[model samples]
Target: MRFSPVTQLSTRFDSVASDIAERLPDTTAGGPALAAGLGIGHVLVAGWNLTREINEFGAEMGPLMAFGLIGGAGLTVCVLAVRLFYSEFDSKQRWLVGWSAVGGATLFGAIVYISILVRLAEGRVIAEPIFVLSLASGMGAVAGVVVGELYATALQSAAVADRQRDQLEFMQSLFRHDVMNSLTVIQSRAEFLTQDTDGQNNRFAETILEYAQNIVGLADRVERMSDVITGRGEIETSPTELRPIVERQVTPLRKSHEEITFDVDVDEVTVVADSLLEEVVGNLVKNAVEHGYDGSDDFTVSVWTTSTGGRTQLHIADTGTGISEELRGEIFERGTSESGSGFGLFFVETMVDHYGGSVRVEANEPSGSVFVVELVTA
Candidate 1:
């Protein structure tokens, strides 16, 4: 396939940068400070020459214009440094900052470029400025790459450390809570299945499959998390169909939960989300099933979808343990409760927010709670 000129340039730029990086020490072996010292040496020599030129021509011309243009050229790199080095650093970043240095170098190049049009435009020796600028470019590239690569390495190291810490905590949390629960459920269901053999015995089998499904889902999550951390997979989003998401998650639950009736009045609408949308729906439905009814009383859950303005709202109303006004917001936060680990709701809330959606819990008419999830309609 053919590529655009812009694409061609970018590819060329990356290839060149990668090749240069291969030659340089990937570690902080040669300090950028040494290169900076070389740069400083040239600056001092140029300053001395420019000083002599200004003094000799002191009677004829002013150094005001020269100082302004030259000073502006020198200051350009200082300004661009913040933007170029504040994030993750890798060898590729060295090239980016080096390019910025080249941009600053052009201001000096402009002096030479414009001088050809009018030699000694300010009665200064053209050769001296050209020589000085050439030295500056050569030394400046070495300094910029050295400094940027070192700084980028530092930033990248710190970021990697933090990410590793988070990944550790995440895995600990998964095993401590989610994975453990699945195991407990599986053990209990297996024992229960062997002992109970009645018309309702299939319910235990279905619940086992459901728990197995959850265990598989948890594994997928861990794998995806690893991919994101290692820069292998990205969170790509699209207009996900809500109807299928609701059906896929709820269908197995219906088989597992025969006692509780699921009144689904959903629309075939689409929302701005990713593959995680189904997980969000599944977690919420499971939350309702687990905590919806009192042991003695019967309860029902009603799910429906409605759109208004540009937002689509999914309502999961359950006549179960209704959230208190005080606990409404806190329920979604990552924590633990008597009935459940709060990670499921926390994951749901996090994913919904990532998709530019909002989820909130409110009191149902007389009893229980209503979870209203507002999503960007697509």
Candidate 2:
């Protein structure tokens, strides 16, 4: 899924705020303390400015006073809402609440700055904008934080619901498309084998075995994919040694396909990933070995890694019949290509992204194709 630029900016803002909140001296008191400060700030900024409007400039009010009132009300709501739901708010919600101050400050700061500039143009020598901007912004920040936390709560709930729905749909699809179909094939093949007069039919047995293996492989792949996809919690990652993992996964493939030449030059590099990284390496190697060999005995699969710009790029090149030009675009999507369940490519895409990395297929220098996976260097 893609996000708009505005959405992306807001997300970044929330993330930065969350980080700061987490790093506070008292991690427990960080968010609430900051929230309380914002409430006090709103009162000070609005109260001081409003006092001047009434006592110094007479009973008539101004935009600054109105802005102060709005900011105070927003701050009140924010504080109330946060206090009410403080116990239930997770890290995601807390960060969003932190962003409220940011939003409020930004909006009100601009308004006050613009308003003061207009007064100066009209030959009114009033208070300095900086002093007022600071206070007015405080009022806005409190209000902004109020809205942020509330919105965060709603958004987080929606995200959880969406994830659960996707999981349900994913399970439904597996049962309907993989298990049901494989079971039907297995049942039919078993009947044929049983009905064989001499009991010497290998085709039925082979077909059943093939389908069973597929189901098993699908189950393993689904588990690996689940580890990458964000379910109810965040995926944890550690610095995984890439060279050892790559070497291990490819060892079996090399032994099974002795006819095919294997060239490996992986670096002894580490990356921010987990044990599932092994599954990624395994699937990629299996994909190349299985799909790259067609008819000839001159098949070769090359694996290499390069580290540059804090990224470790793993390249898997195959010298055989390459993927069709038409299929390359949608290969990463779920159940996309006609060549099996399309789970392998989808798994690679999902896992790599979870590792804050990317995977793409490119045309090799001569024949066949190359899969380039770029992961963050540990």
Candidate 3:
């Protein structure tokens, strides 16, 4: 088959991208080896230069001083490299600074050695042996400064990440254990009051119980958000049937929002998702009913699922005033909504990402918006 230039270039680009992606993770493991190689190179070049000088000038402080400076600088750089390799400063800047310092030191040493040899060959003793020692010391000092800066920056970044992770973990524990327990007690008391009361008092007790349940739900979401931020939660995938889960979530909404109609048309397909799949579908439906309704009894929400090419797509669409183009762009971002509790869609997005899926917002036919969640079928 004939191929165009663009096609050839794209093929080559994909090949290169695949190669890089496969090798990228192992680059860090190669850091210590690379550093050691550079150190050995410095030692060999410096040793050769010093040996030649010693042959001509006999045993002197110059050759010994040169040997000490090269050995010390190379050892220092190697130690720093090893530290960096094991440290948590996995950043491009750290590698750049480290390699640049090593290159600069080696270049400086090579230039100095060449200059001394050129002068000696011409029978012109340009300066004393002390001059050579001074030059090596200067190069070592410059390399030391660069290595020091790299070490400090790496350490600082690692520390900051650790502190943030610790704080998030503490917050997650507090919410999951302490706050959840307190909310449970309040909900239980409210439920008891609802059971014991009559007439107007009973309605008030039910309202308290409803709000309590909402608070508990909010706490659970907050805990999940903390887990996502700290990267402490592991995604446990399983084959989850979609139709029953969707129906279970929608059934409660039907009772709560009698004014809104829900149309479900999901296939009995299983997806590679966790238990949190229900929360994802529930949030999408709740958000639609809460935001899509315009105080009209004619409001309708539709959910459907379709499978194609090894992927399952679950769509939740609403029939009310559609979202504006501006709002649609930032709607999934946390804290982007006017409502203080803007973590609903954020949780949905995080869970979908964990499940190796994707979610997008699109304009529904005629009016309202549609949330399309695409996941891999197991």
TM-score of each: 0.48, 0.46, 0.54
Please state the error at residue 205 of candidate 2 in Å: 24
After superposition, which runs of candidate 1 have C-alpha atoms over 4 Å from their true positions?
1-11, 25-38, 59-61, 64-210, 217-265, 268-276, 283-304, 308-378
Sort order, lDDT high to low: 3, 2, 1
User: Model 1, range 198-217, lDDT digits (tens) per residue?
Assistant: 55776667667667767767
RMSD of 3: 13.9
Clashes of each: 1, 4, 0
Candidate 2 residue pairs in clash (backbone atoms < 3 Å): 78-146, 100-144, 100-145, 104-140
Query: lDDT (CA) for every model shown?
Result: 0.67, 0.74, 0.75
Structure candidate 1, residue pairs in collision: 292-320
Predicted structure with the largest TM-score when compared to the true one: 3
Put down candidate 3 lDDT per residue, 1-378, tens digits, no spaces: 999999897577446534543554345545445555566655665677678878989889977787777766666666766776776644443444344455565567677778888888999877655446445643653474365356447556767999989887876787579877887898899899999999999999899889888888777766665666568767779999999989989999999888888899998899999777878898889888888887777789999998889999999999988788888888889887645488889888888988899999999888889999999999
Per-residue lDDT for 109 in model 1? Answer: 52
